[model samples]
Target chain A: MTRNAPPPADSGAVRSAGSSGSGSSGAGRPGFLWAVPAAVFFGLFAIVPLIMVAVLSFASWDGLSDPEFTGLDNWRTLLDDPVMIKSLWLSVLLTVLGVAVQTPLSILLGVWAAGHQRNRAVLSAIYFVPLLLSIAAVSVLWRAVLDPNLGVPAHATWLFGDGNLFGTQATAIGVLVFVSTWQFTPLHTLIYQGAARAVPPVLYQAAQIDGAGRVRQFFHITLPQLRNSIITSVILMVVGGLTTFDTVLILTQGGPGSDTTISAYYMYQKAFKSFDYGAASAIALLLVLVSTVISLIVVRLSGYDKMRSTMEGL
Target chain B: MRKSRPNHLAGFGSLVWLLVVGLPLYVMLVATFQSRPDYAANGPLAFPEHFTLDNYVNDLNSGFAQYFLNTVIVTVCVVGIVVLLVPPLAYTIVRSRGRATTTVFRLFLLGLAIPSQAVIVPMFFVISEAGLYDNLIGVILPTAAFAMPVCALILTGVMRDITPDLYEAMTVDGASPRRVFFQLVLPLSRSGVSTIVVFSALQAWNGFLFPLVLTQSVETKVITLGLYDFQTERGVDTPGLLAAVVLSMLPILIVYLFARRALVQGLMGVGGK
Candidate 1:
C-alpha cells in the first residue's frame, strides 16, 4: 500500500542528495551510460517537438508549403477570432467551476466518508469508477441519458423539464462541467481523504476536551491542516480543466455551435478540421503556458520549495 | 484516544451523493441488455423486459474485435516500453553525478510541465514527417514519450528511497554498474514499476485526443476513436453502442479492481500530496 508514497523528508532534497551520492569520480563516470536510450527517445519525441511547437507557432503553412515563418500572424488571428475568445472564456469558466465549486464539495464528501468504519473504502471505489472509465464512454453515457427522447429519465418527464440538456448553448457547457465534476469529485475526495487520515487524532481529541464541536474542530484544526492538500487539488483540477479535451470533444465537438469549445478542442479543430496548424500551435502554446504558469505559481505561492529546503536543513 | 463525531446528516448526504453518481451507470448497465424496441418503449431507466446478448453479438460482429485488438496491442506496447525504459533512466538520474546528468533529470522534470495536448500540434508534423501517420507506431511513440516525465519522476522518487550504503557496497565490491542495477535496484523498484505500468496503461487506454489527431484510418483506430465512431454509426442503437462502450472499458476496469490500492496510492504519490 505504501508502494509509491514519497519519502517524507523533502522529496526534492532527496533527489539532490541522492544525485550527490555518486560524487566520487569512479561512480560518476559509469551511470550516464544508463540515461542514453531514454534520453534519445524523450528528446526525439517529447523535448524536440515541445521546442518545435513554440517555433512552429509562427510558421504559416496549411499542410501545403514548407512552413514559412510569419511572425505573430497566428497570434493576431487569436485576437480577432470569436471562437478563440469564446474558447478562452469557457476554459476559464471550467477551471473556476472546478477549483471554486467542485473541490470544496469533494472535500466535504471525502471527510464524511472518512468518518465511517466500514464501507468508506468500497464507497470510495464506486465513487471513483467514473474517473477510471474512459471520458469518451462517460460522454456517450451522459449524452444518452440527457438525450430527452432516448434517455432513461425521459420516462420520468416530470423530473427533468425539456430534457434535451445538451441541445442549448447555455446548458451545454454547464452539463459538460457537471459531467467532469461528477467524474473527478471522487479523485479529489480520495486526495482529501488521504490528507485527512494523515491528520493526527490527538488534535481532534484536544479540541474535544476543550468542548469544541465537530464544526469548530473542523474549521479550527482540519481546514488549516489541509491547506496544502487543498492547494494541490485546486492546481491539479485547474491544470486538468485547462487541458480538458476528451469530455468536450466527445460530448460537444464544440457544438450545437462552437459554444462548448474549450481551448484544447479549439486547437484540435484548428489543426485537423480547419487545417490551420500555425494558429493551432499558437493556441496550444498559450494553453500550456497559462496552465503551467498557474501550477508553478501554486508551487511558488505555497512556499513548497522553501519548505523543502527548510526540511533539508534539519 | 480520540472522540468520534457522529455526523448523521453527512451520512445521509453521502448516500444521496452515491445514488446521484450511481444512477447514470446503473442506467447504462440496464441499457446494455435492452433491445431497441424495449429501450424505446420502456425508456432508459426501466429494467429490460428481455435481457438479450444480441447487441453485443452484433457489436462484436461489426469490427469491435479489431478495435479491441488495436487497443490491447497499443496499451501493451506502451506499458512494455515504459516499464523497460524508465527504471534505468530513474536510476541514472538518482545515482549519477555531474552537470550533464543533473540537466537530464531536470529536462525530465520539465516534461511534467509540458502538456501533451499542447505538444500534439508539433507532434502532428513530426509524426507525419516520420511516415507514422495512421500508424499504431505513431500512437505508441508519442504516448510513451509523454508518459516518461511522470514515469521517470515516480521512479526517481522511489529510487531515492534506496539507501546509499546499498549502492556503495555493490560498488566497493567491484560489481559492474549493470550488475548493481539488476541485482540491487530492479528488485527494490518493483512496486514503483508496477504502479507506473498501470498508470500509463490507463492513460494510453483512455487517450482520445492523440488518436483523434494522429491516426487517420480504421485499421489504426484505438478504442477511444472506435467507441466514438461506433456510437455514431449505430445511430439509434443505444444498447449496442453502450455494449461496445462496456466492452472497451472492461480491461482497465478489471485492472483497476485488482490494483485499486496501488493505483490510488501511486496516484497520491504522483500528485505529491
Candidate 2:
C-alpha cells in the first residue's frame, strides 16, 4: 500500500518529487505514448457534448426547426419564472434539511457499527441496500409504502393516527426527506466509518485512561478526528440534493399540486414536457451556475484540493 | 465496571433508529407479498399473513425479465467501455505535463458541469445522424461519455496516486511506457478501476432520462425506461410495479452488498474533501 517503493534509475529522477537516491541513469524519451484512444473517446463523447450544451443554452428552438439566436431572453425568462423560483427554493430547503437530518444519524450509526467489529460486516451490508437501488425504484417502493389508503403508512397509522397522513404537504416532504436520508445515510456512514477506522486505537486507549466517558470521548476524539469526512459527506449531500430529479420524478412527478417540485424536475418539464427548450436551457444554465458556485465554495471551505492531495498521499 | 444507564440509553436509541430506518423497507417487502385485496384492505405497515409470490410471478411474466436483461447489457457495456477508455487518458494527463493535458482535463470538467438534459434535442439529432437513434449503443455511448468527466477526474486522482516512482522505475528498467502502464499503473489503480466500474454500472443501470427520450422500441428499453413504460401501460398495477422494482434493484443490491468497501472508497474519491 505504501507509495514509497524503490525507484528505478533511468526515468527515476523524473519522479524524484519524493523518493531518494533513484538517479536517472536510463534516461530516454518521456514516457506517455499510449494514451491516444482513451483521449479521443473522452474528447468526442464527454468534451464535445459539454461544449454543445453551453452553446445551445442560448439558442431558441422549437425542437424541430434550426435553433435561432435569441440573446438573454432565455436568461431573462429563467429569472422571472415562478415555478423555477419555487423549485430552486425547494431544492435548497431539501439540501439543508437532508444534511441536517442525515449527518448526526450517520455519525451515530457509523460510530456504533465501527465499535462492534464482530457484526460490522453484516451490518454494513444490510445498510448499503438503498444505495445500490435505482433512485426511481426507491421512489416506487416508497410510494407503495407511503400509500395512505393501501400503502404501508396507512397500516402504520394505527400507531400515529387513522387519518390520511400522506395527503398533507408537510408529511409528504417529511416522507421524501426521510426516504432521501435512508438512501444517503449509508454513504455518510461509510465515510465516517472509514475515518473512524483510520483513527489510531492508542488515542482511544489514551482517552479511556484519561477518564473520558464514551460520549465525551466521541466528541473530543472521534468527531474532531473525522472533520474531513464530515465535510466531504455534507458537500456530497448538498450537490446531490441540488441535482436531484429521478426519485422525485418517480415518486410524485412534482406532486399532488407541485409541492415536491425541485428545480431540476421543473426544468425537465419545461424543456421536454412543455417543449420550451429555450426556457429549459436557461433554467439548466442557472442551475449549473448555482451548483458551480456552491461546489467552488465547498471546495475552498472544505480545503478539498489539499485533502485530495493528502488522501492521495495516504 | 461503571454505570449502565448510558449503555441502556444507547441500546434504546439504536433500536428506535433501526425501526425508523427499517420501516419503509419493511413495508415494501410485506406489500410485495400481499394479495391485492389484502394490500388494499390493510395498511402497508402491517405484515402479510399470506406470503403470495403472485406479484413477483406477474411481474416476471409481464416483460420485467426482458427489461432486466436490457439494463444489465447496457450497464455492463457502458462500464466496460468506460473502464477501457478512462485510465489511459488519465495516465497521459498525469504523465505528460503540458497544455494538452490541462486542456483535456478542463474539457472533461466542462462536460461534467453541462447537464445533458439541456442538449437532448441536438443529441437526438446527432444520434439519428449516426444511425443509432433507437439503438441501446446510442444511449450507451452518450451515457458513457457523460460519465467520462467524473470518471476521468476520479481516475486522474487515482492515477496521480500511483507514485511516479513505479512508472519511472519501469522506464529505467527498459520497459516501454505502454508496458509500464499496463503492468504498473493499471495494477496499482485496481481500486480506482473498480470504483469507476461500480459507479458507471450503477449510472447506466439506473439512468432514465436519456433512454426515455432516445429509444422507442421495447427491445432497446432499459429497466428504468421499461418501468416507466410499464407504469404508463398499466396505469397503476401497484403490486406489479413494486415487483418490477424489486427485480430491477436485485443486481445493484447484490453488487453493493459484496463491494460496499470499494463503493465507499469510490465515493470518497468522487465526494473527496
Highest-TM-score candidate: 1
First chain TM-score for all predictions: 0.86, 0.83
lDDT of 2 by residue, A98-128 (tens): 9999999998887776765455566566777
Query: What DockQ does each prediction reach against the true complex?
Result: 0.51, 0.41
Clashing pairs in 2: A10-A26, A151-B44, A152-B44, A152-B45, A155-B43, A304-B273
* Candidate 2 residue spans exceeding 4 A from truth: A1-33, A158-166, A200-206, A297-314, B1-6, B42-50, B109-125, B157-165, B232-235
lDDT of 2 by residue, B111-204 (tens): 5555565456557667877999889899998888877777777787777776656666676787755566667888888988888888888889
Candidate 1 chain B lDDT trough over 10 residues, lowest sum:
B1-10
Q: Write the per-residue lDDT of candidate 1 for residues A139-249, one digit (tens) a residue.
A: 887877777678854776687677767788878877888899988887788778888888898898888889998889889988898888888888888889999988887
